[model samples]
Target: MLTDTLRKVDNLMKNKFTAILVALCFCITSVNFTGLLTVSAATYGDYTYKVSNGEVTITGFDDSVSGAITIPAEINGYPVTAIDKDAFYGCDSLESIEIPNSVKIIGEGAFRYCYALTSVTISNGVTTIGEEAFEECSSLENIQIPDSVTSIGQWAFYNTAYYDDETNWADGVLYIGNHLIKADRD
Candidate 1:
């Protein structure tokens, strides 16, 4: 009878140990996945950036930043080559932005939903503006795309006063390098 009781107690302890090991593994996996999501991001000054291949990409702006923002040409001696996806998403108080000449790419949704953004000055070195880069910027009136730009992605400026169908701009048209980009009237 004693041997039978000992065997039962041993089996219960083994089962509990196995359950604990499985739970521990699950917890570790969850933490690792969460770390992967935010691992590349690091804050510098008012921006969160990621550095890869000797270049820096501005990943996001600090929520406290307002009004104007001027991205530096370099961060920690690495050229700021790109503005990463959703870099300035939903920054409603941002009014204007000056992207320096060293930047080469503007990632998808980089400036989307910045309702108060009015003017954007993309300097001469940028080559690509990613999809929906400036979408939903209701107040943005003017943007001068430099000749160096080779690709402007789909809906890059959608829902802005410059591209929306409802509002008629003073010129009643929007032109991109002598090509008709958008027009409200004939």
Candidate 2:
């Protein structure tokens, strides 16, 4: 009877150990999967960026940043080549932004819904502006599209105060070296 009781106790301990091991594994996996264990890339000034293949992409910004924000041309030896989707979305206190010449692409909704944004300086190297890149910027007064910009996605400047109908844009139209780019409705 003593041997039987010992065997039962040993089995119970083994079961408890197995359950604890399973629970630990699950917790670790959950943390990694939910990004709680991932480390963010370096932050420069008010911006955070991630680098891959020797290129940098702006990811997020510090919420306390107000007024004009200037994106640096390079961060940590990598050229800032792109702005990720929703990089500056809904930053209501940001009044303006200056994108450096190293940036080539502006991702979808990069600057959307910045209600207080009024001006933007897009340098000469940018080629593509993604969909809704500057949509819903009610206070934006004007923008100058550089000649290097080859494509402007749909609704990029929708709902802005400066938008005018494409055909009736006698004034307040986005221009690239005299070529009309967008004349969105106000």
Candidate with best TM-score: 1
lDDT of each: 0.84, 0.82
lDDT at 106 for candidate 2? 96
Off by over 4 Å in 1: 1-40, 165-174, 178-186
What residue pairs are clashing in model 2?
none
Q: Which candidate is the best by lDDT?
A: 1
Look at candidate 1 and tell me the lDDT of residue 99.
Answer: 95
Query: How many residue pairs in model 2 have overlapping backbones?
Result: 0
lDDT of 1 by residue, 1-186 (tens): 999999999999999999999999999877744433333567889988987767889988976578998999998887899999998999989999999999999999999999999999999999999999999999998787898898888778888877764444447765655334545543
Total clashes for model 1: 0
Give the least accurate 10-residue stretch of model 2, judged by summed lDDT. 31-40
Q: Count the backbone clashes (under 3 Å) in each candidate.
A: 0, 0
Mind giving the per-residue lDDT tens digits that candidate 2 earns over 131-167? 9999999888767668898888888877776554353
